[model samples]
Target: MNAQEILDECAALYTLPGPPKDFGERTVSDRFEPAAVPTLITNATIWTGNNNGTEVIHGGEIFLEGGLIKYVGDRVPSHFTTNNRVRSINAQLAWVTPAIVDMHSHLGVDSAPNLAGSADTNSMKALIQPWLRSLDGIDTHDESYPLSISGGIATALILPGSADAIGGQAFIIKLRDTKDRTPLSRVLEPPYSLLNGTRVDPTIPPRWRHMKHATGENPSTWYQGTRYNEARKLKLEQDAYCAKAQAHQWTGLPAQIPKNLKWEALVDVLRGRVKVNCHIYETTDFTSMVGLTNEFEFSIAAFHHAHEAYLVPETIKKVWGGVTPGVAVFATNARYKREAYRGTEFAPKILHEHGIPIAVKSDHSILDSRFLLISSKFAALRKALKGGLQGEIGQWYKAVAEGKIPLVVDVAKADHIATLLELKAEVDEYTGKSLRLTLTHATEAHLLAKQIAAAGPDVGVVLRPARQYPTVWDQKRVLPGPPLSAQSSVGVLTDANVTVAIGIEEGWQARNTRFDLAWAALEANGTLSRTEALAMGSSNLETLLGLEPQTDLVAYRGGDVFDLSSRVAAIISPARGFVDLI
Candidate 1:
């Protein structure tokens, strides 16, 4: 198969043999019906999702009636408490927080156990597939759901895998269902408007190194193929279709480009109906795409895995004049991939100071859904370190080839890069920076407690457990948490009071990691406050994703030191009503 064949397949998404049918709204089809029992609670400390615990309710009692919080205060509503239909509970001096929301996960779509049939996150046949969706591939039986729920996670935005340059669409769904699955009913928000993809260079599979194995047509085509060629061709094709669509929208001419669904989705982005969520790294993709989006008129929603986003100036004066990306970053465990060599945990601090919101991502399956909360903790901590030696990107490859890291198997394999630049002895001899700042490892974010406090809320972080990489390294599943220290960064992110959230980067694989991260933060002296730790697993996660209402909560022991150290967990959810999964 060739590029023409791939284009032909895309064309099929537009037309069918018969005319379109418009069965206008009449009766709903198997519509959802949430549980009806009203729940009441008395005596607990509650966080109302107001930024930074500003509107916390002390000794609060809540009336959760009809799938929503009817009242939240020190006293429960008389009618709710008196009504025979409402159920009540005496809260055990616990802290009540909004349910955890993992914004970046591939739960059902990538269903665990590491089986081939269940792995539906990416579509390898096409480099650009906006039509693919996480919805169609979701398996309600994925055990990660129940496990994550036990950790107080109530909602997740399941997304497609980042295989091609433009993988597919994502959907935000509730993690609940009756004994019988509803037909297309579990979707809380369908077509979540994120076209997931990645720009990281090392994630490319080794088999695709040969031209014969790199074609986008099938997996067997043998033409002279390269992702560079594919990426270039895709941009041209998308520009052509989107430019025409813009003309139709602006001029009302040519009757709308023959209604191509693929082009139609791209046009939705062009017209601001959707946003692109690409797994990004390095300043090149950031700077280049900023220009690309300007030309296409489609704004990026969030740049996931933007390890080098901090290097991108907040305001860049390009050849045209200036560019404002106005984009958020779902920053993840960086400094692992090649293009992400310059990645830093302090990216959030820098990006925040530059005015960009940062969200932590587990890249589930990369970290595990269970540890999503910790990911945020670590990102904030690492970035808040007082002072540290930064890595120089221009001199990275030289250090790597000189056997500075584990990424390169053989130092002799240097055909691609000829000659190298000399680096300062301090940064290069691994004296000023950490040994972890090598090509395969991560960069350090070292700053004093006062320095981190001064960085302030300007930096927001989404962190995962430190150095927890599973199913990595040529598909080998490496699972072992790293040892913690007093100088850990997780403690510092909290000192700055940054808005933080967590993700289950590697869904089922890292489910237990969230607790591991929290434990590390709690034991680390006076760095992470108990309130901030619990908030990341709850309201902080919700706020980062712009979740609403401040309902759907979890209960935990409340006092001077609040923690997820709860041996028992209780939750309130929009779906499944009020039930403790743990």
Candidate 2:
């Protein structure tokens, strides 16, 4: 469809973006057809993707039929196995789990091989083009599909690239390769989000940034980015637009002027029906975005590429008006861009401590889709190191609270300062870093870290199978120079707390090689346990993506079943035919 016609149709879709037509105007619900057959798998190891707390059945049995999982546990009902048509397989040596789900990707949109012609990642005509749908521009023929599916990726949330501030809508899709033909057959959900790009670029000259999809746009700019009041002023104008949109709710009255597509999209966010998976990083953006969302009474589903999330734990915990967005971070990547250079790998740990769930994305080719699990492992490693630091603080605070150390309340006490310094010295040495601590800092930095660590976990994470793709830059790189130190920390994000799932940010770029990433996670280092790493690649991802209660399973051979090159044995579907993984 031509741009003009597309806009006209979108404008006429005045009823607003809703769920599947059969479901009415309720919420986004699963619309997948279940597997058609009833099958029993006996004596298998099952991983339920709940990383904060594990639910593993060492010798489990399950019944899957009609697409959904009817049961999963240590034993399957006898009646299920008795049915003649119900196939039974002894999967004692194999592990059965849900298919991996990619949270962020540009699979069909960007297409594979990255040619300019198929490079339809953004609707760059203007900064606030929420009506633009990634669904409208997808190419199923992108070779990324079959490869990604074999790598154990079943579902994805595909999105437009981030060039303009408000790029377009994100769409959800199932990774079923039908020779890349027929868009409707592959789509699982569309309008996953009405993309809201933060930090609109003033760098793009006004002449090149005017609206092109509609007529009568000769004079005014979509965003007036004057030299003096550029970012903040422009942001304020955005807030005003959001306010207008939120208040422009429809009552279907004849007197009511039909709200335009842009306003309606913003209204969906404000009403919390749709999530704004925003593109953001810097601490400043986090603070400002939170305030803006609070002002408009909306919530961010997540903040994409939140590189500096560790800097504002308290700010994130404030929870102004609605639920704060999860911090979608790069796994082990940092220091590439000035704004992204700051935060530590432990940002996920820190954010979790502040009551924010974490979501890790590959950012596709930037961090390589295969590294999604690899990144989560690094986050886990960072969390372990931070926990060690907190352990030291906890010991020190115990002495102080127990009155072992005199509570000196006044004037500069040299001994007290020196004592705290000594304690911090031990912590820095143990955790391997220099933390700029002061008496004026919050207790979390001092005593609060001990307090919260003592209490429990802050937030569990969601598994999205995309990442920022690994990169090593000089100026933009994070501190503590050794690259291994950054990548090798792959164990326990605080024993039985913190969650993870897969989010594929750039599928086409990685050609959907998710299992390879899973292999990297498993073999990354000593920090990540075998089961934990496997979970990150498989079950943790499915659960995090909210695709649980599924009977679909992936079965593998070899003790090293999750190995990237060929761990996959078969893809078993109740309704669908078995697919070979290798």
Q: lDDT of each model, Cα atoms only?
A: 0.50, 0.51
- The C-alpha local distance difference test score for the whole of candidate 1 amounts to 0.50
Relative to the true structure, candidate 1 reaches a TM of 0.49
Minimum summed lDDT over a 10-residue window in model 1 is located at: 206-215
Query: How much does candidate 2 score in TM-score?
Result: 0.50
Tens digit of per-residue lDDT, candidate 1, span 1-582 = 233333443343232222114313322223235555677888888888887547788788988764566778888758666768777787764668888777677888778777888888778876666666777788877877777776667777676776565566676677777545841456653321222332122222211000001112222222232122434344456556545453433343332223555545554454344545656555655566566655544456566666666776552223122333433344445555576677655567777677665666555666676654433443332322212224574245334323343121111111110111112222234433322111111112222224323433322334443433433322122223224345344555454554544445466845564575566455546566666666766676554443453676665554223334454456778755766756
Write one digit per residue (lDDT tens) for candidate 2, span 80-118: 567677988898536676777776777877778788878
Q: TM-score winner among the candidates?
A: 2
List per-candidate RMSD values in Å: 24.0, 23.9
Candidate 1 regions exceeding 4 Å error are 1-33, 179-183, 191-257, 313-332, 372-582
